[model samples]
Target: MQQQTGIQTNPVAALGRSTISFVNSLGDIFLFFLEGVRLIFSSPKQLTKIIRQMYFIGSKSLFVISLIGIFTGMVLGLQGYYTLVKFGSEGLLGAAVSLTLIRELGPVLTAIMITGRAGSSMAAEIGVMRISDQIDALDVMDINPMAYLVSPRIAASILCFPLLTALFDVIGILGGYLTGVTMLGINSGVYFYRIDTSVVMADVAGGFVKALVFGIIVSTISCYQGFNTHKRTDSVGPESVSNSTTAAVVLSCVLTLVSDYVITSFLL
Candidate 1:
């Protein structure tokens, strides 16, 4: 007779534990978003803070976003041109590049870039504040941490992500133009006409919606991680921030991909 496996887990217990964890995570994010919204509505001078946050998130991220957008479009142009040339349809490269960027690549890559740039930084900043008891200090002063600390960040993310995505799309299309038309001799008329006729307001709107959703997820996850960071000694502070930043980036990416599918299904 075969021996049973050691360390067997109870199926019911495992399922129960997963279900509880999922529910807890869901509730936490809901509360976090709700509190942030409540604070935004109640804040008298929140516009100033939101504006500063926007500059930080939007302006600071602009260069990297632009750089990546152009390169990505050029790469798509090259690959797409070669692929379509096999079928003597190289003129359609612009349409291929535009559709790919607006429908999928733009929002996804922009979110990931923001996650790498600002999301990690946001998490670390919050984590540092938490570890140093700065959050508690705010509490002592009768300030709502959600308003002062979280609201501006979350709002800024929501506002900036779509705009960034839009810029990425435009720059990428231009890059494709540079590579496809200028380099490969694709007719400007055909390229522009195809892109114009093929890409509609609905495509851009769908990309915008994805960007907005990704922004909400990234900001909320990063802030939540920071708000709950564990206290550490001076030597371990860096380690704590590093861990929180990593967690924030990883969670942001995973959620972005998953939500992309969900949103795409509905949009389609």
Candidate 2:
């Protein structure tokens, strides 16, 4: 005798599951951004917290960023000089360095640095709080977690990133100068002149805008990942920190690049 087995399935089940997942993800992202905006306008009461975070995220990370920026600029100048020399256009080296650093590289690199330095820490700290019920403790005490935790970090990012980018821009330009004039023997006056002429307020403005947007993205994503650490307290271990960091870095990079294209297209 052959036994017949019944196959049980719902045709729309997969579709419904996908739809709900998508909607939930969208809602999470929306709320993340909304919380950021809400914190932006809340008050000045969190100034002390914001300043401390700025010191951690911006001031403490300066040495690393400056070192990276210098090397990046030097390499860019050397490569650009050689490439431009092929066409007897080595004089354009300054313009190349300034344009690349200010328009694209500076903001993006600073953001990446901050992500590795601060974003991971932010996520891990908040994730631990969530797992340990510290966040719930705040709720039980009538303290607003959004105001106390997320707001200060968001504010700090907004204030810190642009400043860091500007610092990177200056350090990068100096490195390019050293490479162009000292290593390549390009005339100092010509180098500065070309850079001055090539770079404008619009370029600086666009880059700062990119930095600000990236800051917001990084803060929101990291905080959201941390805040959502509910079900799996044990699972919110070291691996969760790594996952959150990876997500923040990847998302920040994608958003920065995409926003760059959009901003440049609109501005130009």
Candidate 3:
């Protein structure tokens, strides 16, 4: 009877353990953020390292970002022109394209592109280092891993995201110009005039702010996943890396949209 009772309760016990583990993971993330904040203020000498990271993640990512931006803008112009012309407001195409790129598409698309390019590489590298105990070695040598490993990434993301978004905005606008004037036979002068007149400084500023925040979210989440990597007894570090990458992408995308809405509301 006792043996039978034990067997019947095993699943319930497993469920309870799983719940506890999930709660513990949440706690770990909160603590990680706290530690990150502390280290960010305490360590000023890591700026150089952060700049290097920005060069790799942001500067090196320009080509892919430009490609994505150009295509996205071209598509926007093509689709927007058809819809606007249906309403006899084809002249609004330039404003529509610029607003879309500046207010929504620019920051979000650039962030997604960066996440695919840099976020995965960051997670994989850090996870592998964690599994190999190199992080432990740094700790032993009196290096704060949060400062040396994580803070630079956070700083880099904060700086790079805005710059990348700006680049995306330019490339996207140029693509829109090509599509609207060359392909769609829209007046180039009117298109440029509408875009230049309708887009305010506030629109551009807001997009850059969103990019900056998105960068922080992506880098922080990816670093957290990487820093906490543990080699599964049956699995490998690649699994952790992959999971981290997915988390970074999802969280960054969500946060970007959420922040965009909030900022737009406040500005309006």
Candidate 4:
């Protein structure tokens, strides 16, 4: 009876332990994000690193962002045209496409794309460094790895996300113009006029705000996952790195979408 009792697991204890661990993880991630963001302004030397990351996370992503934006806008134009045509309001396609792009799809899609491309890279790179002891080496040499590694990425993301979202919005609008005006016989002047009349500064601001939030979420989650790769319970070394990278991308995207809804509700 004593041995059986000793070997038995307590469900309540297990649940409590799991809850505690989850809370501790949340606290750790929050602190990690604070430190990373705080260090972004620690020195002017970080400018170089920030610029490099911007190139990787922003400039390199332009083609894909533009491609996706155009197709999304084209599809929106098509759907909006058909839907509004039923009521003789097909001319409003431009307003529909522009508003949709600027208010929602633009920022969300841009963030998701960057998360897939750069967020995964960030996690994998840092995870590899952690497993290989490179991060520890930096620590032993008195280097602040979070500053050296994470802060610049976060800064770059903050700077790049809004810009990318803006680009996507513009390209998407042009795509709508191509479909609605060129292909579907929408009056060019009417198309642009509707867009100019329908969109306001508040709509634009809200999209940028969402982009900013997504940037912070993606960069922080990616870095946190990678930074703690060695602590993963399920795997070690390369497998752990891979797992972290997957988690980073998945979590970043999920959070970006969830935050989008929250931000939209507040903005509205």
The list of candidate 3 runs beyond 4 A from truth reads: 1-31, 41-44, 231-237
Q: Which pairs in model 1 have colliding backbones?
A: none
TM-score of each: 0.92, 0.88, 0.85, 0.94
lDDT for model 4, please. Answer: 0.94
User: lDDT score of model 2?
Assistant: 0.83
Write model 3 residue lDDT over 66-175, tens digit each, in one string. Answer: 99999988998899889999999888889999999998899888887888789877777888889889999999999988888887888788889999999898899889
> TM-score of predicted model 1?
0.92
Cα deviation at 257, candidate 3, in Å, is 3.7
Q: Worst lDDT window (10 residues) for model 1?
A: 1-10
lDDT tens digits by residue: candidate 1, 62-109? 999999999999999999999999999998988999999999999999
lDDT of 1 at 179: 97
10 residues in a row with least lDDT, candidate 3: 231-240
lDDT of each: 0.91, 0.83, 0.83, 0.94
Cα error, residue 129 of model 4, in Å, equals 0.4
Candidate 2 vs candidate 4: which has greater TM-score?
A: 4
1-268 per-residue lDDT for model 2 (tens digits): 1222221244466677879987887698778778766875677777788888889888998999999999989988899999999999999999999999998899989988888788878887887788778999999998889888888888899889999999999999899988989988999999999998999999999889888988887888777777776644445565665566566667766766787788778867
Candidate 4: C-alpha RMSD after superposition: 2.1
Look at candidate 2 and tell me the lDDT of residue 242: 59
Order of candidate numbers by lDDT, starting with the best: 4, 1, 2, 3
